[model samples]
Target: MTLKLAIQSIGVVYGDLGTSPLYVMSGIFPDGIKHEDDILGALSLIFYSIVLIGLIKYVFIVLSANDNGDGGTFALYSLICRYAKASLTPNQQAEDKEVSNYRLEVPSRRLRWASAMKSLLENSKAAKYLLLVVTMLGTAMVIGDGILTPCISVLSAVGGIKKAARSLGDDQIMWISVVILIFLFQVQRFGTHKVGYSFAPILSLWFLNIALIGIYNFVKYDSSVIKAVNPLYIVQYFMKNKKEAWISLGGVILCLTGSEALFADLGHFNILSIRLSSCLVVFPSIILTYFGQAAYLRKHAEDVASTFYSSIPKTVYWPTFVIAVMAAIIASQAMISATFAIVKQSLALGCFPTVKVVHTSRKHEGQIYIPEVNTLLMLACVGVTLGFKTTLKLGNAYGIAVIFVFNVTSTFLVIVMVMIWKTNILLIILYVLTIGLTEFMFLSSVLYKFLEGGYVPLVFTAMMVTIMFIWNYGYRKKYEYELENKVSREALVTIMSNTNIHRVPGVALFYTELVHGISPMFTQYVTNVSSLHSIVVFVSIKSLPISKVPLEERFIFRQVEPEESGLYQCVVRYGYRDAKMERQFFEKVLIDRLKDHIQNDVAPATDKQGEPSDHGIAKVNEESVQKVIGVLDEAIKSGGIMYLMGEREVIASSGSGLAKRFVINCLFNWLKRCVRQQEEVFNIPHKRLLKVGITYEV
Candidate 1:
C-alpha cells in the first residue's frame, strides 16, 4: 500500500481507536477518580492492553488469518472450512478449490492436533452448530457494537456541550445526539466512497489536535504520570483495590474497543496500511491522550466524568468539540459498514435471510448498502441512545459486547494458528496466556455488570444467535430433505421419456438447490401438471466459500440422458464475495452455455426410426453455431421462457420434540415468511417467474 492509502486507512479503519480517548477515562472511573493510584493503574492497563492485544495479537497476528483478502469471524471460518472440508453448505464443489488462495498442501506430523481438530469438526454435526454459534456470537456482537459504539461515542462527544455550557441539560445533549445519529444512518446509502477522502483530513486533524492537547496537559499537570508506563503500577492497583480493580477491567477494555475492526475490515485496506496508520498515528495518539487524561485526573480528581472536555484549553474548546463529534461520526461509520459486510458474508454462508444488498460503489464490491439492516440499526441505535442516556451506562453495555467479541476472535485465532498456520504449540500457549487471559478478565468483569447496562448486548447477542441458528438449522434440514427426497436422475429421465405425459411448447428453467438430480418441487409440479416443457433446464445457483470465482469456471453444464428430449442441468457458481449479476445477464449466460452444449456435446435430433433428421438445421461449425443460436433465440423469443422456483415451508414432524417443533414450525417458518422468495432474491422478473409451493415435514 502507498503512504497515501495508509493515511486514508487511518480515517476508515482506525476511527474508533482514534476517538476512544473521548470516553475511556470515564468508562474506567464512572464515579470519578478518587485516588492517584487508580489513575496510574488505569493508564498502565490501557497502555499494555493496546500493545499486547491491539498491536501484537491483531496488527501482527490475526490480520494474517484473513480469507483471501476478506476478514471477519465468518472469513476465518471460511478459510478453516476450505482446509478441513467441514463446511455445512452441501453444494461445495471441487471447482471451489481452484482459487489461488484455496490451495492445500500435505500436512506434516506437526499438524497432528490440527488434523484431529479437523476430524472433530468434520465428524460431528454438533461441532458444526457449535462453530456456527461461536462465529455468530462474534458477528452478533459486531452488530451490537454497530449500535452501541455510535450511542456512546456520539453521546460522549455531545456531552462536551454540557462541559462547555454548564447550563445545558441532559435532554439537550440527547436530542442533539439523536438528530446527528439519524442523519448519520440516513446518508449510508451514498456510501463512504463518495466522501471517504475527506475522512483522512478530519481524522488527521483530530489526532493531531488530541495529541497536542494531551502533551500540553501532561506538561501542565502531573508530568510524573508518565511513570504509569511501568507494569508494577498495574499490580499495585489490583493489589490495593482487589475486587474494584477486577471490576475495573470492564472499563479499561474500552480502550481496545475498535481493535477488532482492524481485522474485520482487513479486506478493504491492506495490512501494511493498517499497521502503519495504527502504529504510527493512532496508537501513539491514543496513548498520549489517555495518559494526558490520567495526568489531568490525578490533579483534579473530580474531573473524571468530564476529563476529556475539562482537559481541553479554553481557546480550543469549540474546535475540539466539533472535531470530537466528527471523529465519533467517522468511528460510528466504520462499525456500521463492518456490520453490513458481516451480514453479507452471513447471507452468502447461508446463516442469514436473503436481504437486498446494494453495492454502493461499483469499483469496490465490499462497499455495500443494506437498506433494511441500516434502518433497523438506526432504530436500535436511537433506542440505545434514548435508553442508556449517558456515556457511563452505554460504556457498561459497550464493554461486554466488545470484550466477548474479543474472546470469540481470540478463540478462533488459536484454532487457526494451530490448525492452519501450524504455529509452535508452545507459542500458542504463550499467546493464549497473554491475550486470552486479558480478554477473560475483561469478559468476567463485564459479565459482573450483567444487571447494569451489560445485559443489553447479551440480549442482542441472544436474539442474533437465535436468528442465525434457526436460519442455519432450518436450511440444513431443508437441504437434508432435498437429499432424501429428490427424484433420481434415471427416474427423471424415465418420466421425461414417458410418451403418456403431455409435452408443452416453451423453455422452462427450473431453479433448485439440489445440483445432481431433479428437486422434489419439480416432482410435485410435474405430478400436478402431468406435462413437461419442450425445453427443460435445471439451473442451480451455488455460492462457494472463496471470495471470487474465475470467469471461465463460473458456469458448469451437464447434458441429461436422452438429449433429444431437450433436458439439461447447469450449475452457476459464484463466490461469497462475487457480485450478483443482473437477471438478464444471467439469462444470456445460461442460454449461451446451453447453446454451446447443444452444438458441441448433444447429438442432433433423431427420428423414431433411428435416423438423423435435419429439421432445417445448419451443420455444426463455429459460424453455424451462430446461425443455430439465431434459430434457438427465435424459438426462445416466440415460445416464451419462464423461470420456475419453489416456495418451501418446513414443518415439524409429529414425533419432533417441543423445542424442535418450535424451531421449525415457529421461528424458522416466521423467518421464512420474512425472507424474499427466490425469484425476488435473484432479481428475476416477476412476470416471467412461476412459484411452486411445497410443504415438507422434517
Candidate 2:
C-alpha cells in the first residue's frame, strides 16, 4: 500500500516540478547563452537550490509541521489556534475539548519565552490581525500560482513544435496550447482517482525517458558538465556577470515552481509517500536532466532558446515531444487540483465565499471539484497564455507567486519551531540565515521585474486579499451582533408562556451560526406570529480546523432549559475537509440522536416532584421515556419537519470611517448577494423552508 501511494504521488505531487526542465534552461538564457561557463554557474545554483530549499527546508522540515495530516497555510494557522487562543471566533465551547482529535500540547510553565509569545498573540488584537493578513497573503499567492503555472508549462511544451515544423508560426503554437489547456480542465470533474491512475504511469515513463535522454546528451556532448556541481562556479559566474546573473535568479527560481504543491497536497497523501517519491524518483531525475541540458548548451549555445527540444536526438524527438506535452498537462492538472483543495479549505474556515463543492471520489474526502473555481481558472489561464504570447513573460509572473509563498512558509515555520517544536533559538537563527537569505534574494530578483510582467500576480493577490478581508470582517461583526443580542433563556420562557402564544404541531429546526442561546431571528418569528412549534431544535453547524471529524463525535447535544420545554440545541461539527451531509441523511441522524438523548439523559430526571411510588424509579423512568418518544413520533408523522433559516442584510453604522463603510456596506454586501444562499447550500425544499429576515448594522 505504501509503495502504491508513493508511485501515485509522483504523478500528482511532482508533475509540476518534473516538467519544469522543459522551460528552466530556456528561461535562464532567453536571449541566448553569453558565455559557456555561465551554463555551469546556473547549473550549480539549480543543484544547491534543490538540495537546500526543496529537499531540506520543505521535504524534511516543513512537512513535519502539518496539522494532523493536513498541510497548507491555513493548516499552520489552525495548529497555532488550537495551541493558544489565537482564533477570532468566540463560539468555541468547553464541549469542543471532548472531541477525540482536538489534541493540544501545552508548553511547560518554565518555558517563559514560549508562554510570553503565546500571551502576546492571544491578548493583542493587532498581532492577531497581522497573522491573519499574512495567512491571506500566502493563500492568495497560491491561487496566483494556479493561474500562472498552466500558462507557462503548456506554452513552453507547445513551443517544442517549432523544432519539428520550422515553418509553423508562433500563433499556431499558442492556439494549440490553449486548446490543450481547455481539454485538461474540462476533464477535472472526473476526479483525481481516475486522472491520477492514468497520470502516474505517464509521469513515471516521462521521468525515465528524460533521464535516459539526459544521460545520452551528457555523455555525447560533454560529460565534464558534472564539474558544475562545485559551488565555486556559482561565485565565478556571479563575479563575471553580476547584474545579469542576479536578474536571471527570477528564471532560476522556476525550477522550484511546484515545490509548494508537495506540501499543499499533503492531505491527499501521507508524509512517507511524498518523501519517498521526492527523494528516490523526482530528485535524481531532475538533476540528471538539468545537467544534460547544461552540457548541450555548452556546445550549441544558439539552441538555448529551445534547449530541451533542440538537444533531443533526432530519431526520438517526436516521441519525447508527445510525452512532454502530456507531462505539461499533468503538471497543470496538479496545480488545478491543488487550487480547488485550498479554496475549499478557505471556505471551510470562513475566509472565502460559499461555492458549490462536488465530491469527486466517494472514497477520498480530500478529492473535490468546484465548478465555479474551475471555470474561473480555465478562463484566467487561457487569457494569460494569449496575453503573454511568450514563456519569458509568463516566467517573470510565475516566479513572484512561487517565491512569495516560499517566504510566507518560511516565516510560519520559524514560529512552529519556537512554539510547537521548542527548538533551540540558535538553531532557528541558523535556519533563518541559510534558508531565509536564499529566499530573500529570489524575492528581490523577482521584484526587480515588477514592471516587466511581475505586477500580474501582485495585482491579482491584492484583489484576493481585499475580498477575503472584507468577507472576514463582515462575518466577524455579524457573529458579534448575534452574540450580543441573543435571546436569553428566561426571555424565551416568558415568550413561550404568554397566554396569546399557541403551539403548532410540527418540528422546527432553526439553523444558526450561534452555538448557544436562541437566535434573534427566532424571537422575531414568535413575536410576529404569536406561535411556537411543538418541538424546537437550534442547529448550529461549526467547522473545525482539522481535516475530518470522526463520525462518532459529529453531533453534540444539549437541552435548552429542561426536557419538558421541548427545546434542544444541536451542534453539528465538521472538519475543514469533511463533506456536508445531505438533507434526508442529516435529518435522520439528528432525530435518532435526539430520541436517544431523551431516553438516556432526560427521562429519569423528568419526574422531580417527589419520590417514586411503589412501582419504583425504573417504572417511572420507562413511563416518562415512552411518553416523550410517543409525542416526538406523532409530531414527525402528522405535522412533518420545517427548516427555519435567517436571512440577514448587513449595513455599516453611521459613525464608521470611509474604509470600514466601503468594506462592509459595499464590498461585503455585494459578496453576500453573489454567493450561494443558506437554503441552497443545505438543499432545503422551497415548500418546507422558512426564512426570517433581519437587518444588522455592523
TM-score of 1: 0.94
- Give Cα-based local distance difference scores for all models: 0.84, 0.87
For model 1, the superposed segments whose C-alpha errors exceed 4 Å read 104-109, 500-506, 596-631
The candidate that wins on lDDT is 2
Q: Candidate 2's residue-wise lDDT over 89-192, tens digit each?
A: 78787877788888856555436656777888889988888888999999999999989988888998889989879898878889998998899888888885
TM-score of each: 0.94, 0.96
lDDT of 2 at 397: 93
Give the TM-score comparing model 2 with the true structure, all chains together: 0.96
Deviation of model 2 at 231, angstroms:
1.2
For candidate 1, lDDT tens digit of each residue in 445-495? 999998999999999989988898889888888988887898886887778
The alpha-carbon lDDT assigned to residue 340 of candidate 2 equals 87
